[model samples]
Target: MSETTHAGNGISTEQAGVEQELVDTVLASFDKAEDPRLMEVMQALTRHLHNFLREVRLTEAEWNTGIDFLTAAGHITDDKRQEFVLLSDVLGASMQTIAMNNQAYKGATEATVFGPFFLEDAPEIPLGGDIAGAAAGQPCWVEGTVTDTSGNPVPGARIEVWEADEDGFYDVQYSDSRIAGRAHLFTAEDGSYAFWGLTPTPYPIPHDGPVGKMLKAVGRSPIRASHLHFMVTAEGLRPLVTHIFVEGDPQIEIGDSVFGVKNSLIKKFETQPVGTPTPDGRDVHSQSWARTRFDIVLAPGSDLR
Candidate 1:
């Protein structure tokens, strides 16, 4: 690289010659975008990307490697598996976006990442019914109430729940079945709900693709703390996407791979002796059961369109 100096500017003209021209041309191409927001975003993105390349003095080999990695990520993605989300999560971009979008409300449940495993049209179950569906794990009784910021019950709220089994595998992970540990139900008149589920256990995030290779290269673990996923919504409130983490899970202190754990969302799972009667009138006979209560508070707002 030869340096060409500008007498008045006191800077190397070569550094700005080709780089600035490319950036200006790219940014100018977006000037005719019909949507104002699209134009603004493209302009900002182009400038930032060009600035990054200049700062790093990126080599052609390195840039090609990045393109190849992203191509691999896209090729691995499908209807059930999302490699791009895993890539965003490991890079911290997903968590940063979640934090920016979810400002804290007075009494609303804190929001977290909606992991890639959530299935559309999960089976609907009656309140107090079991969602385990032949999955193997310690039986647990989960009960809760839904209330607004003003402390009034929000009846008929839809609650969607899902989790992994004791062996740390979601229903989608199994080749033979895809219906365990997931259900949706509505709150009763008093905003109370209950269901049978498994005690959450620490599990590794899916890690056999590009994201996993990246983690290995960076010496980061792929574990996520034990937690039950929840998505709650009502007639006129901001929807809550969160999880109730198991209090004593060792992975919690290490931090979740997806960055979804919140201190306010942690809850204790108490062990009940065998032969104990449950709130829903089921008796624990051969195996002891675990129990926990998690009440939800929704932020008062217009429904999401």
Candidate 2:
């Protein structure tokens, strides 16, 4: 029957198909949807899901199993944790879509997945503050400058940083008392910023649900390369969401969990002697761990101001 006739009534139709049923259900809920963007999202999602079902000829048993997996995923979410984000990480959706959209602002730095561990209010600190705490790991002195494409520094840019501990776990993953590996540093008058944090270590994503099952079925590992996450923004420059992966991270040149790793973003942390002064004016640089520098370039824009 025609779509118009099927609109208001659940008219019995033996010839009804899965796509038709999906359209009717989705359209009914979106009857008041007037935004073009919202309509595009709904239409694309509907088309893709229908196409996927037809391509696989999905069975009822398989669908039920999928539903159970999703249920478990949602059940795992808590006030401080998000299982849905984990699912996206494992499925590579987070990186694929975020990276695709971030490509327009290339030359800033390669953006990566921001696994759900960032806090709403990270303590604001001055540049070169010690962020590594007392955790015993490779000492990495990271210094960088926020600049515009024309090569001028974007002074007073705020930079937020977070990375795994020497043991590959964020401070939040350990105890609330432990806030290591997370720092908020702002650029100096010349747009230069510096800090000390432990070198990030490779770690595994949460593997407990439908996404984990899919990983097993595909014979893929849940490990992600070690890296540092940074969100930098200035008064007039575009905000940059990116990461600096550890040099030689096996997953860097090879298999990244979400294909978000880029060669140019890999940084080598070089060890220093034990008698040199630390970046923060401490006289222990020689005995310190290592150091790496990264300069960020932002495109001209006042959108993030």
Model number with the top TM-score: 1
Error of 1 at 229 (Å): 0.3
Tens-place lDDT digits, model 2, residues 1-305: 64442333453343346457766787567657899789778877876787687557689999998898889878878766687887787677988877666665546655677787877677776777777775657777889888887788887888889877767677776656677778787888888989877777887765665666778889987777888889887877666777888786677655766565877778887777777667566655346567899998887664322
Q: Candidate 2: lDDT of 235?
A: 73
lDDT of 2: 0.74
Give the Å shift of residue 288 in candidate 1: 1.8
lDDT of model 2, residue 296: 88
Off by over 4 Å in 2: 1-31, 208-210, 283-288, 302-305
- Stretches off by above 4 angstroms in model 1 are 1-11, 303-305
Counting clashing residue pairs in each candidate, in order, gives 0, 8
Span of 10 residues, lowest total lDDT, candidate 2: 5-14
lDDT of each: 0.89, 0.74
